[model samples]
Target: MEIPIMFEESDAVEGHHDGLVISLPVAKEHGSSANIIMLDTLKHMNIDEKNIIIKSTMLVGFSGETKKTSGEITLATYAKGVNLQVKFLVIDTLSSYNIILSRPWIHEIRAIPSTYH
Candidate 1:
């Protein structure tokens, strides 16, 4: 099948991580319809198909190569009412966390994660 080209060969942007990226629910809202979890896998995601954004089509076998998307996904945790519409990529490799939390997500949520704190 011929996959239609979606993204152009644009200059690489600054602060781009070449690994997994995911959304983390920080706070919870009352009377919400969505479930917020710490980590979300592809099989357990509630994707909004109506708003699909093509990030890129892979053609290689490397650790950096991952499926990308520009879609909004509901997190399973606190602050479940808010929907995170940031760009996230998926990697089928070993990772400490389900979502890598890319720079875009950090900037959007204005959060700081501490390691072993």
Candidate 2:
């Protein structure tokens, strides 16, 4: 099945949700800056902050033990007639992409990423 792609600009990323947030390439050789969501992004998406999961270890760098960010928020994706809820950590910085999908979200949605289109 070929999945449709949707992009949005929320002072953050402008790419498909793909069940996971994907940040632009960071300074590293083959890594990204950060895979986090901003407060404004959540507000723009109209996702309530209370619904966020707080701290998620699914994030690449997060340990999911201590409180790292202000908090996390939950955002729902309506794609292919499916309503999926995703948790995002709230950040206050800037990057090429605002949000990046983590392992948890990808696993939840059971999605696979392709680079050779």
Candidate 3:
């Protein structure tokens, strides 16, 4: 039920076109649902289905508490005016990992923070 932080130096970057990587833990109970939800969320966000990619890998460690079963999902796509690059979503079920969201070009038209007023 806990989310751990997972990221590597290579995965981190500052730019819209730069590749963005995200990692998260997938519990056996919620793994399937999590994947579905994630994909649905992306679709809702208007991301092209062809641009998204998903993959799974096995991670080995000495932690007895570790699930020994982990998986990663990478979502890469481009956005207009965003200098789009690559975005990744990773899930480590055993470690209760974290999900990182990144983008290169995030612009705020009004620095004052838009208010409905």
Q: Model 3 misses residue 101 by how many Å? A: 2.9
lDDT values of the candidates? 0.39, 0.51, 0.34
Q: Write the per-residue lDDT of candidate 2 for residues 1-117, one digit (tens) a residue.
A: 978764434434445454433333222112023336766666666556675666643334435433246666655554333456655567654545556666665555555554322
- Winner of 1 and 3 under lDDT: 1
Mind sharing the TM-score for model 2?
A: 0.47
- In model 1, where do residues sit more than 4 Å from their true spots? 1-23, 26-40, 46-83, 90-97
Candidate 3 structure quality by residue, lDDT tens digits, 1-117: 756545555654444453333333322212011322244444445645565445553433336332222223344333332322333443333222233232221221111211121
The whole-model C-alpha lDDT of candidate 1 against the native structure comes to 0.39
Off by over 4 Å in 3: 1-37, 58-84, 90-99, 102-117
What is the C-alpha local distance difference test score of candidate 3?
0.34
The 10-residue segment of model 2 with minimum total lDDT is 25-34
How big is the positional error of residue 93 in model 1, measured in Å on the Cα after superposition? 6.0
The clash count for each model shown is 10, 6, 14
Per-residue lDDT for 1-117 in model 1, tens only? 855534334544456555433344532322111121222454445534443333343423236554333333433343234456433443344435544444444544544433212
Poorest lDDT segment (10 consecutive residues) of candidate 3: 108-117
Question: Which candidate, 1 or 2, would have the higher lDDT against the true structure?
Answer: 2
